[model samples]
Target: MSDKPLHPRTRAIHHGIRRSQYGEMAEALFMTQGFAYDSAEQAEARFIKAGPDEFIYARYGNPTSRMFEDRIASLEGTEDAFATASGMAAVNGALMCFAKPGDHIVSSRALFGSCLYVLDVLARFGVEVSYVDGTDLDQWRAAIRPDTRAVFFESVSNPTLEVVDIAGVAALARAVGALVVVDNVFATPVYSRAVEQGADVVVYSTTKHIDGSGRCLGGVICGTRQFVREVAEPYLKHTGAAISPFNAWLMLNGLNTLDLRVRAQTDSALALARALQDMAGVSRVVYPGLPDHPQYDLVQRQMGAGGTMIAVDVGSKAAAFAAMDRMRVFEISNNLGDAKSIVTHPATTTHSRLTPEVREGLGITPGLLRLSVGLEHADDLIDDLRQALA
Candidate 1:
């Protein structure tokens, strides 16, 4: 066979497949927690240093989980990966593994509520974190100190839909030898070139676009083999953050159609964003793909597509709730990247935990409705939003 790399679509389907003696057509699920050893000496030797195909405990690793890790690593163009119980587990493990008491970390101020909570947890543990406006390169440059251990940010800010300059921030981090850790859930693996753009670590919530149907919760940390095996794995396994084999299998299957699902959803999102902008009730529409977005050029350079989420301001909390109530096709939920379109009032749902002042600073207005566009036809979705706005 010719020595050539496969396309991402092909890799998503065929990579990391391990078939059993039965030679089953489908990927077999190995659900056992512990592996039995052939001999006492063999078990000791394996535990001392498990080979690529060996496993001692489920919390440490499993064949099905390994398959999910390998496939995602390949897709993300990373040397290795570690699957976690949820997206937050991956984020916590990635940041907390190397962050010490005195170590300083810089982060974009616009982050998911849970991510902010994790940073708070780290703060209580003595790690110093500085927050900066992610859209401002100057803010990032000013915040990163010589002692900065890592810089964390959502590649695309949640709810408000601000797109950060991945390459610009990565360059700043490199100057101080700080690791660039990116929450790339919004970018989706299909549109991400985070590794190529100089990110040291890329994290994803497989429950979102990767699963594509809101079926299960899973997350993965993708980076160098040293980071995955030596740094992240030790912390995650010891803390019991391993993804269930069943969830891993579901994520593996989710990867197969990720490209198709995300692209379709993105198209629907753009349509809705454009329609919302001109609608009578909507005062604003935030989507990276829109030409008027503050970071439109960055979105084109980085993701090349708008992505599957949009945020619209319908004027007030009452108006937002009324619009959501009037929706025919969209479901009311906090989750994004689902096959069924979703509408969430961020001030009341996802980001409600944040103080009102903080939410306003992040542009999560009481009137803001976060839209997760689904696989439905663009015209149908647009019509649904039109009536909702009407």
Candidate 2:
């Protein structure tokens, strides 16, 4: 193979490989839990210090999982990556690995409910977590402390679709010697320049788009080799958060078409956002691609395109439900980043766990609905919405 830089679509398919003796055309799944050695001495040496390509136990590493990790790491432009059982596992592992009791963490107020749980629950255990307006540079600067170990935020927040300035936040964190950990889900790998823009660590819930068909649940954390192998691997392997080989294989197949799927979905999303902007009963539309979005310029600079998700605020909960219920093509569900478009009502679903005051603070209103655009034809989706609104 040539050393020339390959496009993401090409890298997704060809970055990682482990050929068997027979040289199978597809990546073979090593489903076994353990690997065999030639001799007792070899096993002993492996236990002490395995070769770079060797595997001792499935918990620590597996061929299929390694392939998925390698492929994602290459796409994210990171030195290494560790696969996890789920997206939250990746989030918790990344934060807990570097955080200790009494350490401080700064995060954006706009986060998925589960992420808020992690940060708040950690606070109960003596960790200090401060929430700030992610779009505000001054808030981030004001929140950073001398002892802050890490700063975490979604590059584009959940439900509300707020876009945080990754470069600005990373620069602020770097000044205080804090690691910048970004959950770059909304900004898919197809549009992500997180690593190049100064993110110290990047995390993804591969279950969303990577498995475009929704066949499996998986996540990965990408960073420097030392951080992934030494810090995250040891904690994840021992805690049983390692991904299954089967799921990893499924994700690998999904990777082959990720760029294609995400781009198509993003196109549909932009169209949907534009169509909804002036519709009756629709109060506001939140899509990074839309010029009306508060951070439109930052999104253009950071992600190039608007992305594949959109959020709209109808007049009320009743109107939102009517719109969602009347739609023929879009499914009403909480999940985002799928091949099938999904609509979610945040106040009663994903963000319900938050107290009413907290939910209101995050702008997850009764009328707010999040839409994850898929590979459907833009006109078909628009027609469905038209009839639903009428």
Predicted structure 2: clash tally = 1
> Candidate 1: which stretches are off by over 4 Å?
none
Candidate 2 residue-wise lDDT, 1-390, digit = tens? 988888889999998888889998888989988999999999999989887689999888899999999999999999999998889999988887877888999999999999999898789888999999999999999999888899999999998988889999999999989999999988989999999999989999888988888778999999999999888888888888888999999999999999999989988889889999867778888999999899999999999999899988887889989898998899998777888888889998989999989888888888998988988898988888778877
List TM-score per model, in order.
0.99, 0.98
lDDT for each residue of candidate 1 in 35-112, tens digit (9 for 90 to 100)? 999999999999899999999999999999999999999999999999999999999999998888988999999999
Q: Residue 110 lDDT in model 2?
A: 95
TM-score of 1: 0.99
